[model samples]
Target: MSSLENILYFQSALGFLANMVLLLFFIFIILDHRPKPMDLISFQLTFVHIMMFLIGGNSWLADIFESLNIKNDIKCKVTFYSSRVMRGLSICITCLLSVAQAVTISPSTSLLAKFKQKHKKYIINALFYIWILNLSVSSDMMFYVVGFTNVSETKQMQVTKSCSLLPMSSIIRGLNFTLSTSRDVFLVAVMLTTSTYMVNILHRHQRKLKHLHSISHLRASPEKRATQTILLLVLVFVVMYWVDIIISLTSFLLWMYDPVILTIQKFVIYAYPTITPLVKISSDKRIINVLKSLQSKCHQIF
Candidate 1:
């Protein structure tokens, strides 16, 4: 057994435990009977946990086949492409949340000022589009991605059939990189832009108010809190994703295998999902209260 296998085993085990915790949290939220936004965010977090599980399990699944002769198998395709679907949807969900809040908080006379109030009922329809759009775009992943045997001719390396992109020529590689990363870039850009716009709106509103300590200034406390939470979420996502992109580019240029980068990359892949629930709990009063009540009951039982 190599360090790679060991790390993979550790990652899968750790991720499984985290995923279960998230599942329990989701169930608890639903049982708590909260309404609208919290419920929606809880469901979204549940999807994120599932996404991490599906992607992280690749390590364990790779270890199952002792040899490195993976082909274009249907099972491999399902596992690999399904994760893509969830990944895309996760990003879109965040983008929607950011933009929705932006619209909700727009100046009263603006065109989209009442968009949130008017269209809150159509959230289900919006979510359906997110799922369909992600699933459709990610369909190409099943064809291009597969379990491939990495056989090194120049050096002695273990041949493993890991879930990765097909061994393609330079042209194909360029095309894939351009198309996929372009989509990701667009989504991330929209997310960040909307977040910034929301922040700007809040700042402007604060400046226009006469008294900072007056209740008039504090009437939008909920909005202020929500903005802060969304800003934190956006910051975390940007830092993690951009660093991952940088490391990916550097790794592509490197000559030898650096386990450090590989390890960091793997950890970062799971970092957002792991931190997401905790972040939500810290920022959300409803989830916080629910957790506190559960804690009190547990203490009494023990």
Candidate 2:
């Protein structure tokens, strides 16, 4: 097999393993909670991420099978379509999560604060809209994607029999890129802005506590901890996502499919879902307690 094929296989295997770990962590979070609004959003994101891993991983696996003279068009198409849907949904859900987090941290006096009280139903509604919007936008791919044989002549190769919204005419591709980039920028801005305000609020609250000689300074209250955790997660997300974006954009502008850029993008995309579970484990006492209980039970069983 060619070196390019070998690298693809290795990256896909790594992504699959990482996604499995992320799935297990999110499952732990779900089993330990009664599905708060935030939990629901996290669960949705995790599910999509797993779907992405499966779809992308399967495509790579299919390549290996084909190289060994095995043909499975049905499996290839299924993997391609599933991957497309999952990727679209992943992007939509990321935006939903940012909006949800912003609403959660909004001041009670702010109009957005109403979401805190009435979020469950609204979240359901918004999720429905996101799925519909993504499905509509990505439907064009179903017509263009054919198996490897069809794309063997093209510079932009298809890993499997899947269609992407990306390999269109330059004008169309630019439009799609603009839309995707704008959505990401807007979501990141919202997350950073709301998180910054929340941190400031927590800081002011801390200063007020300092003025009270009767009250002792604590390590960190639940609200403060949550605020800090959210801030850290957002920072990690912004840095990782923008780095991937910059690499991708630079590659596109240079009209080159640089292997280094592809590798970095793959890692960032695979790692994104792991962040939420890590944030919860670090910030939520209930989740930590559940993990501890599970560990003790396992030890006893052994």
Which candidate ranks first by TM-score, i.e. highest?
1
Q: What's the lDDT of the predicted structure labeled candidate 2?
A: 0.66
Clashes of each: 0, 0
Instruction: Give the range of the ten consecutive residues with the poorest summed lDDT in model 1.
Output: 154-163
Q: Residue 227 of candidate 2: its Cα lDDT?
A: 62
Per-model lDDT: 0.66, 0.66
Tens-digit per-residue lDDT, 1-302, candidate 2: 35655665665565555555555666776686567776676667767876776666665666776787755554555566676677667756766665677677667888888778789889888888888877676665455455545433464544323432235577865775787678778777877777777777777777787777546665787656766766776777778788878876776554455445565566676565555555555577866676688899999999
TM-score of 2: 0.74
**Compared with the true structure, what per-residue lDDT tens digits does model 1 show for residues 25-87?**
667866766556535654775666666666656654555543554543655776667676777
User: Residue 25 CA error for candidate 2 (Å)?
Assistant: 6.7
